[model samples]
Target: MAKSGNKMATLLNLILVLSLVLMISIAESRKLGEEAVACDSVYGAEEGDTCESVIQKFQLGADFFLSINPNLNCDNFFVGQWLCTEGTVN
Candidate 1:
């Protein structure tokens, strides 16, 4: 009887720890979703707009814009170029 009781107690403790971890994960997921913002540009790139200018107007630090748009040629951005301004890359 004593051995059975000890086993039950250990199982309950394990369950409690698992529940706590699950709850923490759920809360963190919610927080991350709330913090995430959509990455869409309102205005298209105008004629003669450079990648550096776009980065500056969007408040992105140097290299951040290029990092977001890997296909984009930083030094050869044409007017009317569109790009994503937010969201996870992968």
Candidate 2:
């Protein structure tokens, strides 16, 4: 019974450690994505990409994005669309 309990405790500890590592890895990837340089650069829209997500990834405000990209359809996203990022950067 004691050995079984110890095994369970070790398994629980391993699970916790793995969970923490996975969380950290996810966070780091998000951080790297958010650090993209969009200022004065033209970005091509990828599949499943949204204008809001792109703006957020570049740390841009809606107003700033609009000012740089005149006549842009920000409400809808199209793959292969070119986006100008003049005043938007992380």
Candidate 3:
């Protein structure tokens, strides 16, 4: 009857919410693992430091800089941000 249909819909909604939570948890775990990088050297950003400036100062290749700092957004980079001058992504 109507009551039974309502119960079924509620149960389905609960299941859907739980499934979404599980998916989010899995995605977050994977992201953490991917972002884990071990740094041999680090550099703190100063005023007027662009990605290019940092790379040139350290004599680093563009590709190498990107590899070490996988999550870096060059356009929005801020002063006081610490970057890996030498590192390996795990």
Best by lDDT: 3
Number of clashing residue pairs, candidate 2: 0
For residue 2, model 3's alpha carbon misses the true position, in angstroms, by 38
Better of 1 and 2 by TM-score: 2
Task: Please write out the lDDT profile of model 2 over residues 9-88, one tens digit for every residue.
Answer: 99999999999999999987675533344446878888877778888878888777766776678668788898886654
| Residue 64 local lDDT, model 1 | 58
Per-candidate TM equals 0.47, 0.47, 0.59
The sequence of per-residue lDDT tens digits that candidate 1 reaches over residues 38-63 is 45554577877777777777787656
Model 3: per-residue lDDT, tens digit, 2-83? 9999999999999999999999999877754455678899998998888999999999999989999988888877888998
The 0-to-1 C-alpha lDDT of every candidate, in the order given, reads: 0.70, 0.77, 0.89
What is the alpha-carbon lDDT of model 2 when measured against the actual structure? Answer: 0.77
Q: On TM-score, who's better, 1 or 3?
A: 3
Off by over 4 Å in 2: 1-39, 87-90
Pairs of colliding residues, candidate 1: 39-86, 45-80
| TM-score-better candidate, 2 vs 3 | 3
